[model samples]
Target: MSMIEVHHLPPGTRAGRARAWEELYATQVERATVTLGESETGPTLSSGTLGPIRLVRIEMDSGLLQRTAEEIGHVAEPAYSFLLQIAGQASFSHYGQDCVLGPGDMSLCNNAVPYSYTAHGPVELLLIRAGIGTIREHLPSPEQFCGRHLRAAEGLAEHAVGLSQSVFFQLAADLPEAVHNRVARNLLDALATAFAIGFDDLISSSAVLTGRHARVRLFIEENLRNPDLSPGFIATRLKVSSRYLRMIFAAGNETASAYVLRRRLEECARQMADPACAHLTITDIAFGWGFNSAPHFARSFRERFGEAPRVYRREKLAALATGGGALSAGATESV
Candidate 1:
């Protein structure tokens, strides 16, 4: 099953609702100052994790939210948030740009910097937060696009918004982990495409490189179970020189070997924490995810997860049994 969380202020006094709004933003979204504009009704929030991505659905009355530079220091992991306005009207200010969004409008915001959002009235929003590294390869300079509202009724942007909304609504706590991860990846890809529509010339100029990079990533994902996966092997399979392959990955602030190792370790960790894999031995799980040596896998797993694989799996399973759901046993290290 996947992990999901729901929070609500209920029908309460204005003060109580304001308190709930503050807590919800601090914990679920990011550190921010939330002011209730109406102060008549409370807010409701439902959020869940889909692999590396986080989806949040918020329904609230008029409010003004601000995340100052001082608050950004409190964020341990920086991410990019894509918001789809489901109803009402709102304006966002970030990256020296201020834009108003109506229903069916989408906008991107970076959590690393200060931002402000003001809702004109009651609003409903569906937001997707993804690791910066996950989308950086596609949109090299996301700041330029941040705060620029895109009409969801036009072109690829519309399809992308629809895809994200459908996935968010259909996600369930009991869905297969693989399905959840795949859907997350798909949504990211769709968003990348949607964001690129605003910069057609830029995308056209880099189409070849972007296409190749995507192909390489797809190849790596498809063959993660191959113990012999390496930069040389991957380069050979893609018919590219090893040096060129390294250059491509380097441009994205990653090395081919490091990328392969990270993916393998991530796969092993996912399987280790999966409930269905409880019957498998730790060593078996490691090898199944392409690790050739148990000792090496254990060492790498500990380095990545801050604990041994066995310990992580046990703790995560225990947490699940107690209904204390977590996306991972430990916070994921930056890519």
Candidate 2:
């Protein structure tokens, strides 16, 4: 099948246009219910895929598109959809957060969760969807940014918005798969930088303890591959006492050690579910993500995920081979 396609309803009744768009969305994106006003015009969509990344541009009159919990369950894989407001305005609600986005603004949606978008008037939007593994590969704890409005005029976010617009414009062009893949990767990197910088700025301006917590979290995320990553080592590197480090996590109602272990296990789970890591053994994934003991890793994996590592990997692979694999609910939940 071709990697790109455009969809526009023929001159017809508003009802006809709504039905057409509903079907188009289900095929190109996930299953969504599109509703149009009686006097509104039809919607137009142009979509393209680059590796595991999907790019879409949509324009329409006042309307709404929603994906409910049931609809979310039907999705084949967990992903994150980044939305950029190209023109007009739209209201988005997800994860107990709501925001109205104007031209140049952006927002994120976790596809595994229920969400809705309402276009106030004539609106144009550019959206990019990437798999969970691909997203985690770039951003640390992406869920924190989901549902928050990202102003395009901000520091790195401005650059990210520009990059996203350029990428969307390039999606329809005839290009080699390798070129598309490279562009997609670069886009992810730019977005990750924007998110990281914004998050850092937010925490840096907070109280001293909060700032230290943020720094420690970033440090752990960056060093998850190091088998020696531990609370004591992190405290040493940050020039803080071990007790103080523990106190920071305690203030957040979690232990520093527990936080580190959870992050490492989550990273391991992500890599195990990714097809690119198929060549790596389960033990290798555990060790690479800071688990020093195979037996301990196995016990923890089962305790947290409710299954043995080998069994989990095998099931994921089998489901993937049949094109029906769905991301586990535990792995896809917002961090």
Candidate 3:
């Protein structure tokens, strides 16, 4: 799983940064904390599995609200920033567009667009970043969503809070898989969903689809050495719904089942090419890739590389014997 980093900054220094934000731009920034356990100690707190996004929490007193607004103006310059002000009151302006927010209100901002915002006193804020590259990957024109405002659904804010609490709680517990799976997937989905909707794209088409592919690719790469690996196992391990997993493959321009087989065949070829493995017979390579039956392995190997595994391995050895190459390939066509 991807890890999250949490940070704890001192109050006064944090307030100063918040005031700088207010003075610099039309927005004030607050001192913040690491929201997730993605990192140990760093500027970015995150989890490994969430991909490109980062989560954070911040707080500022009512006195520093305006003073910190200026700093936000700059923070908004590079990424799509979101703020869920869980408490307090504020009215914001994004190049003259106005939105009033109070406790439980969520706002979305794009740094590339100029905006001004004022909050009432100290409040709890949960913010998330949908990285520059991530937003662009979902849209051809990234600027379209820039410098805009967004309000969170009541349920959404509640859920975001729940996700934040759950991620931290889960990390501390370090519980068994049964306890963590649902919450873990939900946090990813919720955070990703929030960003997807904030950017005004099809939430289902974006985050869920992209995430599924990412999970699948991760599963594939991790099990490259496991000969018994298969699409069925991958889907099961992901806890994916059957129909949904297929759609993910479709979106990724692949057939889940076919891709796994091809990968295994490819891995076998790599092993065959190694001089250190030349002493091993071809059947040794086939079984190592999880092939159970001798004939089935040869037929599949031939189909994958357009030649029997024995022939391919023999050719390499032959070439080596003739001084064409140093180490020849080795494998047996028969078990």
For lDDT, the strongest prediction is 2
Question: Tens digits of per-residue lDDT for model 1 on 2-52?
Answer: 356778776677777777788888999998877786557657788888888
Count of backbone collisions within predicted model 2 = 0
Overall local distance difference test of candidate 3: 0.52
Question: Per-residue lDDT tens digits of candidate 3, residues 1-335?
Answer: 32434443323454454333333223222322111111222121222223354445554443222211234334543665555666777665432235777765556655433344444554555555566666555443333333234455633655765566556545544535454545544654564455555654533467657655654654564564466677677778888777877887786467877776676676566557545477777678767666677788778878878887767776765653535643433333453
- Candidate 2 Cα errors over 4 Å, as ranges: 1-3, 38-40, 201-335
- Give the lowest summed-lDDT range of ten residues in model 3: 33-42
The per-model lDDT (C-alpha) reads 0.75, 0.76, 0.52
Cα error, candidate 3, residue 72 (Å):
42
Clash totals for all candidate models: 0, 0, 50
Sort every candidate by TM-score, greatest first: 2, 1, 3
TM-score per candidate: 0.58, 0.60, 0.37
Report how far residue 154 has shifted in candidate 3, in Å. Answer: 42
Residue 70 in candidate 1 has what lDDT? 56
State the weakest 10-residue window (summed lDDT) of model 1. 326-335
> Which has the higher TM-score value, candidate number 2 or candidate number 3?
2
Whichever of 1 and 2 has more TM-score, that candidate is 2
TM-score of 3: 0.37
